[model samples]
Structure formats: C-alpha cells, structure tokens
Target: MDKLTIALPKGRLFDPVVEILREAGVVNRELDDDSRKLILEDEQLEIDFLLSKAVDVHTYVEHGVADLGVVGKDVLLEAGASVYEVLDLELGSCRLVVAIPEEAGITSLEELPSTGRVATKYVNVAQEFFDQQGIQTEIVKLNGSIEMAPLVGLSDMIVDISSTGRTLRENNLIEIAEIARSSARLITNRVSYKTQHQRIKNIIDDVKAVISKQ
Candidate 1:
C-alpha cells in the first residue's frame, strides 16, 4: 500500500495522459501543468508525478527513479532504455518517416543513393533503419528544426516523427519511407513491477479501462 511515483512526459502528450489519469480515477481533481512545480502530488491517492521532458521518461524508469512512466515509442527506440513496456496508451499517435526535399526528385527509398547524409534527432533509429535496407547514411543529430537541414543542403534527407503531413508540406519535404508508427507507451521498472504488483496493476487496469472507451 505504498505510494507510487510515475514519470510523465511534459509536452504535447501530457494533457492527454492527464485526462486519462483523471478519468481512470487515479487522481480526484483536475491536474494542471501550468505551474512552476515539477512534481505533482495527490496525497489521498498516494501518488506522485514527476513531470519531465519526453526523452527522459524511459531513463528515469530504467534507473528506478520512477516506478512507472508514460513515453513515446520513438523515444524508447532512440534511448534504448531497459524497461518493461506494460501498455500502449495510444495517444500522441505519429509516424517516424524518412523525408526528402521535393526538389530531390527521389520518390522512394530505392531511388535514393546508397550513401547519403540524414538529419534527425533519432540517430539510433535512423542508423538501424537504413542499415536494414542495405543503405548507409551518415546520421547527423539535430535536437530541433530538423526540417531546415535538407532545405539548406546540410543533409540529403531527414528521419523525423511526423504527426501530420502539414509541417512537411510547408517545408517542401516529402515522406519517402516510414520507419515506424509511434504512440504513448506505459513502461515500468522491472523490480517495481514485482514489488508493487497489485498497486501497479490496479492503475494499469484503470487506465486501460479509460482507454478502451476512447
């Protein structure tokens, strides 16, 4: 009957996850992120939330700093963190794609050269993907503004997550390859999963129930 600490990504996925938590009866009151506080507590429920960047959720759970976490599949792939993926929240749905500038005249992954430069924050994903296709690419890691790389000739293409094609269309980028689909995932610390089995399972069931209705 101990308190459980959960790591939640603090970005676009935050609101949706919070809504699920509320609907699942994990928290009694409405949760708000527009605050200076990094941790939010629900004393009655014996739950504490660690609000963090999307990329660090897996790390915290893997290190046991958090018993559970909500993160994206893209981050889990890029970070290669060791944690049990308990459930797919299915929020923040998107796709990881390889895109090239419209002027490149490349219509598919087959049309691209054997060796080229790719700009992406997901270096591991990009490397693994191209290697599987028998193509070699120099992955340039850029934290943000990945679309700008191809426009300025910094890279031949980009491996990025695109929720909608609008951003790519605005930047004149066309997706030629889809590496993977991504969504919010629930992950648990290995040891914690066993040590706090029922408590964790209760929340998982609650969340799953809420998600099934959506």
Candidate 2:
C-alpha cells in the first residue's frame, strides 16, 4: 500500500489523534520529540503526518493534499467547505454560544435589542443564528480572543465556542444563548474516500470500533 498522508489539527486535537495512531500501531513511539519538526513519518506503515491549524485541516483534506484530517465541528460549519465528515471522534468537546456581560440582563435571544452589536470568530454562523431569531444585529469579526471584545465594549455580545466556561467567567461574561454544539470530527476528501475506499474504511472502522467500546 502507498503512504497515506494525514493532516492533524495542531492544537487540542493533536495529542488525541496521535495517541490513537500509536495504539493502532501506525505511529512511532518517539514522534513527540521537541527538537524534531512537528511533521513525522512512519516508514513501516507508509504514513506521513503534517501539522496544520484546525481551520485549515478541512481545506487540506478537501483539496486532496491529505487523505484524512481531524478538525473541530465549529471550524467545519464556519468554513462550509465540501468534505466527507466520516466519524465523530467525540473529543475536544464544546458549544457555540452567545455571551454577554452579566449586568446586561439578557435572559433570552428574544430579549436582545433588534439592532445590537455582536462579535465572533464565526461571523456567518452568528449572522444566520440572529436571522433565525428574527433579531437584527451588527456582526463584528475578530480573529482571536473574542472574549476580550465584550469586556472592552467593542461589541455588546459575542458568538464563540466554550468548553468549561472558564474563559467567559474570568472575563465576567455569561452565556445567554446556545447557538449549537460541537465536537472533534474525523474527515476525509470525497475523491480520496472513493479511490482509497478500503484503506480509508479500515481506518474508519478502527476508530468506530474504539468509539463503540467506550
């Protein structure tokens, strides 16, 4: 079999996938060395590993540059890119929510003013959510640290992902509305899934087996 190229999301999802591969007998035990580059190769299994941002993993796999990818549901929906979401890895769990200052006294989505300001990394998703709620608001796009926006009065509220709510709490914010739920997902290119069906199926099945027993 030819080498399989796998795109791994660099941050939170990296270690989990790497551990899975190690258990499945595909990754080298010494792959996590700090001095070594993040990308690694396993000659015995003909596997090539590349580290990429969570948002870019889907694009890399969708473009066929990688045979498989691990990405978060938040990023997947935000991109709206074409790809096969094969399995839910059930890792890096979080929820997409609308948060605001505690003193704002917001109790429900309907209670928000018709014309308000909203900040988020997920601009499209936030707009769609507000549209569905029949609320009109300004959408502000922030590249990083969205929580800080509401703190500094840049925006009235923010649509962002939260896992433990620690960041929001520290920033003196509270979640007023939950837009959606998200988790880490295993994805692949459509063409690659078709061309390398058996190999891909084997990997998928391996993951499913592990998930089923958990």
Candidate 3:
C-alpha cells in the first residue's frame, strides 16, 4: 500500500480531528498542539500527518502533497479548489454571513448603496455571493479583523465566518444575511482517491463509524 499523507488544519478543528483519527486507529502517537513539528508519522497505519493553516489544506490536497485533508467548508467554498470532498466530519460548525454596523441603518442588501465596499478574508466567496444577488460592490481583501473594516471606515460591510453571533454583537455589527453554513469535511486528492481506493475507503468507513456512534 502506498503511504497516505493527511493534512489537518491547525485551529479550532484540530483537536477534534486528532481525536477522530485516534478513534479510527489511524494515529498511534499523541499529537502535541504546541509541537514545532509540521509532520508526524504513524508507521503502523502507514500514514503521515501534516499540520497546516485551515486555508492551506486545500492547496496541499489539490497539489497532491497530501492525499487527504480535514478542512472547513468555508475554506473550500472560498478557495474553489479542485479536490474531492468525500465526507462532512460535522466539526467546526459555522456560518458565512454578511454583516454591517448596527448604526448603518441597512436592514437588507437592498438598503445599501448600489456600489459599496465589502471586506472579508473570503474574497472569492464574497464576490460570488454578491454577484449572484446582482449587487455591485468592491471587495476589500483583509487577512484578519474583518469586523474592524466597517467600524474604521475601511468598508461598508463584511463577509465573514461566524460560529457565534457574540463577536458581531460586541463589535456593534448585525448579520444582514447568511451565505452558507460551514462544517469540517474530509477531502481527498482526486488522483489519490482513484489510485488508493480500498485503503482510503477503509479509512473513510472507520471515520463514518465513529461519527455514527457520536
């Protein structure tokens, strides 16, 4: 069997994903979140794990650097990368939403200026969503702190992933619309899925079984 490489996102989803892998008997050693190592191997399972930023998981899998990856649906939608999303792990649940300042007096997309500025880390997702709604807006790509955009006059609104509405409320932002619900998913490289069918199937089945028990 060819050695399988799996990519795990390093954030809120990390610990849960590691626990699932352990339950599926795919990982033998304890994974230290504080470890500096980017790669970990389990000889018994013939697997190598790559810890990466959530946004980079798709890139690693799409480039075939890793055979499998655990990432959020939000990243997948934003990236639009060519990778086979095989299963929803049901972890890291969140929503992609459009938000505006509480005092903006914009209760709906239609209330905003015909041409406005939107800020987000998810540029692609934001563009697609607004374009589909026939709303023309300039997208400001921000790597972090999207909430500050509207507050500081950088943008009129923002598209961001929200697990809870707490952050938005605290920042005096209101969710104007929900673009999509997001959860962690199991994705595989297209070629790897075809070339390592049985092995990959076994791993998927193990994960499904564990999820079923939960």
Candidate 4:
C-alpha cells in the first residue's frame, strides 16, 4: 500500500495539525516539536509527516514532495503556489495589515507618496494589494522583523501578519489597512490528489468530521 505523505508547518499551526491528525486516527504517538528529526512516521496508518518551516510547506506540496500540507493562508497568498486548497482548518487565525510608524501621520495609503518604499516578507501579496488599490510602491523583501523597517527608516511602511496587534503596538506602529484575514488550510498537490484519491478523501472526511464537531 502507498503511504500518504503530509507536510506540516513548524510554527503556530504545528500543534493543531497534530491534534487533527490524532483525531483522524492516523497519528498514534506523541509528537516532539523540539526534536532534530524532520520526518516522522506512523507505520500502522501508512502515513509520513514532514515537519517544515511555515514558508516552505507550500513548496513541498507543490513540488509533490508531500501530498498534503497544513499552512497559514497568509503564506499561501504570499507564495501563490499552484495547489488545491482542500480545507480550512480554522486554526492559527490572524490578519495581514499595512502599518506605519505612529508618528508618520499617514491615515491611509492615499496620504503616502504615489511611489513609496514598503518593506515586507510578503512581497507578492503587498504588490498585488497595492496594485489593486491603484497605489504604486517599491516593495523591499525582508526575511524577518518587518516592523523594524519603518523604525530604522528602511521603508515608508510595512505589510505583515498580525495575530494580536501587540507587535505593532510594541514597535510604536499602527495599522492603516487590513490586507487579508488568514487561517490554517489543508492544501494538496494536484497529482497526488489524482493518484491517492481514496486515501486523501478518507483523511479529508475525517478532518471535516473533526471540524464539524468543533
């Protein structure tokens, strides 16, 4: 029998993904998040779980290295990976927002210059959002700590994911616009969906049943 390969993001969504898999009766052992092992297996259910960085989950699924992935919707939009979004796990909820320094005095995107510099890890998402708003801006991609961009004069503003708005507040930045709301989603590779139809459907149905009860 062919085993199902599942990729799970290593951050906030990890615990929830584990819970879902346990509820689905596919995970029988305790998962150790701090372990050096990246790949885990459940021989009884013929499942392999690949633990990966949040930003790389989509890539793993898209390249067919993993049949399914659990990742935040924000990462999905930022990557724009070609994959089937099969289900919303409704976990790790957050919002993507455009923020500027508290003293910037810019209440909206319109108040900024026609072409301003914006820093973010989500370059694609920022570009698309600004384009749709008819705003032109230079997008500077950063790997982490986007809030420091405006503080250190690196950029005019930033687009980043905010779960509690605490980080923005700590950095003395205020949100000017909401880009999108995000949550964990179950995504599948197209080819894997076709080749492992029954196995995937059974897992999906099990997850759906768990969701319905929540």
Candidate 5:
C-alpha cells in the first residue's frame, strides 16, 4: 500500500497537529518535534510525516513532494502558491497588522503621514494593503527584527504579525491597521487530490469532526 504523505510545519503548530492526526486515526504513533528526524513514517497506518520549516510547506505541496501540507494562512498569502487551501485547522492564530512607533501617537493610520516607509517580510500582502488605503510607502523586506525597524528609524511603519500584542507594546509600537487574521490551514496538491481522493477525503472528514467539536 502507498503511504499518504502529509507535510507539517516545524515550529509552533507541529505538536498539536501531530496530536490531531493521532486523534483522527490517520497516524498511530507519537512524533517528536525535538527529534532530529525530519521525516517519520508510520508503518502500521501507512502515512509519512514531512517536517519542514513553516515557510517551505507550501513549496513542498506545490511541487507534489507532499500530498498535503499543514501551514499558516499567512504563508499561503505570502507565497501565492497554487494549491487547494482545503481547511483551516484553527491552530496558532495571529494577525498581520500595520504598526508604527508608539511615539507617533494617533488612533488611525489616516493620522500618519500619507507617504512613509514600511518594513516587513510580507511584501506582497503589505503592498496590496497600503495601495488599497491610498498610502504610498517604501517597503523594505526584512527576514527578522521587523519590530526593531521602526524603533531604529529604518522604517516609519512595520507590517508584521501580532499574536498577543505584547511584543509590539514592549517595543513601544502600536498597531494601526490589521491586514489579515491568520491561522493554520490544510492545503493539498492539485494532482494529489485527484490521485488520492478517497484517502485524503477520509482524513479531511476525520479532522473536521475533531475541529467541529471545538
């Protein structure tokens, strides 16, 4: 029997998703996040687990290396990958927002200068949001330390993720606008959906039952 492969993101959402797979009877073994093994196979259940960085999950799925991928909604929007975004797992919820230094006090984005500079890893999403709002800003792409950009005067604003707002507050920044609310999502490769319809549908149904109870 061919093993069904599911790609799971390596960071925050991994353990809970692994637990969900267990509860759904898709896999019968406990997978360790701390383990060095990136790929784990469950012989009894005929399933393969592909553990990878959160950002690359979409790429794996798009290329059919993974039949299905569990990743964040932000990743899908940022990567703009061609895959079926089949379900939202409702795990690791967060918001992508437009944030400016707290010292530049005002309640709304409108109160800020129309032309400013923004920093973020989400270039495409941020560009679209600002354009829609008629705000013209130079966007700088940063891989990390997005909050520090505004504090250090590298940019006047930042488009980044805020989970509890604690990080922004601690860094003396305030969220001016929310671009999107995101959570973990289930995505499937186009070809895999057609080739492994029954197997994939069964798992989706099983996972849905677990989520519906919540």
Candidate 6:
C-alpha cells in the first residue's frame, strides 16, 4: 500500500494541526521544535509528513506531490489554485485588511485616491479587491515589512492580514476595511481526491469531526 503523503505547514498553524491530528490518533510525534528535520513518519499508519512553508503547502498538494496539505485561508485566497478547499480548520483564525496610517486622516476607502499606491504581498487579491470597488490603485508588491510602506511614504495604503490588530495599532495604522476572515484549511489536489477517494475522505471526515467538536 502506498503511504499517504501529507504536507503540513511549518509555522504557527502547525501546532493546531498537530494537535488535531493527535486527537484523531494520526500524529504521534512532536512538530513543535525548530532546527529539526521536516519530514516525519507515522509507521503504524503508513503516513509520511512533509513540513513546508505555509504559503507553499497548497502548491505541494495542488501538484500532487503530496496527497493533502494544511494551509491558511489567506494562502488559498491569494493563490486561487485549482485545488479542493475541503475543510475550514478554524484554527489560526484572522482577517485580511486594508489599512492606512492613522495620521494620514484617511478614514474610509472611499476617500482614497482613484489611482493611489497600495502595497501588499497578496497582489492578486489586492488587485481584485480594488477592481471590485471600481478603484484604480497601483499595487506595490513587497515580500516583507508591508506596514512600513505607508510610514516611509512608499505607498498610501496596504493590503495585509491581521489577527489581534496589535500590529496595526502599534504601527499607528487603522483598518479601513476587512477583505476576508481567514482560518487554517485542509486542501487537496482535485486529481488526488478522485484517485484516492476513500482514503482522502476518511482523513477529511476525521479532521472535520475534530473541528466540529470545538
């Protein structure tokens, strides 16, 4: 029997996923420490674990490199890859928001420029949001330090995710609008789901059952 290869995200989201998997009696080892190897094996169940970046987990599953993946909804929205977003894990819950400097005196999205500059890592999602609003803003794609854009005058506003809003507050920024509320999700390739229907469904059912209880 071929072992099911599962790609697990390697950051904050991993803890909850591991906990849930343990509850399901699928995960038996620690996934908590850093400086350790990525892959792990649950010998009894013939499960292979591949630890990867949160953003790239979906790609692994989508490409059938791994049968399944645990990723954040932010990644799902941003990537928009052709994969089955099976379950909302409801862990690592947060919201993606558009924010501006508090001192900038921009209280609402409506008051912003028609073609103002915006910065974010989620360029596609950001563009789609502006397109929906019928607004035209230049998107400045940044890999990191998105909040600094408005502060240093690199951009007028930004599109980013927030959990407690503490980062926004500390940066003297306020959320003008929320793009979407996100949580961790279980996703799989369309082909994998079709080919491994019973196995995939069982895992999905087990994970969802655990989530439903919380």
Lowest summed lDDT window (length 10), candidate 4? 26-35
Poorest lDDT segment (10 consecutive residues) of candidate 3: 26-35
Clashing pairs in 3: none
TM-score of each model, in listed order: 0.96, 0.93, 0.96, 0.94, 0.96, 0.95
Give one digit per residue, the lDDT tens place, for model 6 in 104-168: 78888898777789999999999999999989989999999899999999998999999999999
Candidate 2 structure lDDT: 0.86
Worst 10 residues of 5 by lDDT: 105-114
> CA lDDT of 5 in candidate 4?
88
User: Cα RMSD (Å) per model?
Assistant: 1.1, 1.7, 1.1, 1.3, 1.2, 1.4
TM-score of 5: 0.96
Off by over 4 Å in 5: none
Candidate 5 at 171: error in angstroms?
Answer: 1.2
Pairs of residues clashing in candidate 2? none
Name the runs in model 4 displaced over 4 angstroms. Answer: none
lDDT of 2 by residue, 87-197 (tens): 998888999999999889887777888888999989999998899988898999999999999889899999999999999999989998998899989899899899999
After the best TM-score superposition of candidate 3, give how far the Cα of residue 107 lies from its true spot, in angstroms. 1.7
Better of 4 and 6 by lDDT: 4
lDDT of 1 by residue, 1-214 (tens): 6889899888788898988988988877556666678888889888888888888999999999999999999999888889999899989899999999999899999999999999999999999999999998899999999999999889999999999889999999999999999999999999999999999998899999999999
For 1-214, candidate 5 gives per-residue lDDT tens digits of 5678889888779889988877888878878777899999988888889989999999999999999989899888998999999999999999999888888886687797789899999999999998998989899999998999988889998999999999999999998889999999999999999999898988899998988987
lDDT by residue for model 4 (135-168), tens: 8889999989999998889999999999999999
Using lDDT as the yardstick, the better of models 3 and 6 is 3
Candidate 2 deviant stretches above 4 angstroms: 33-38
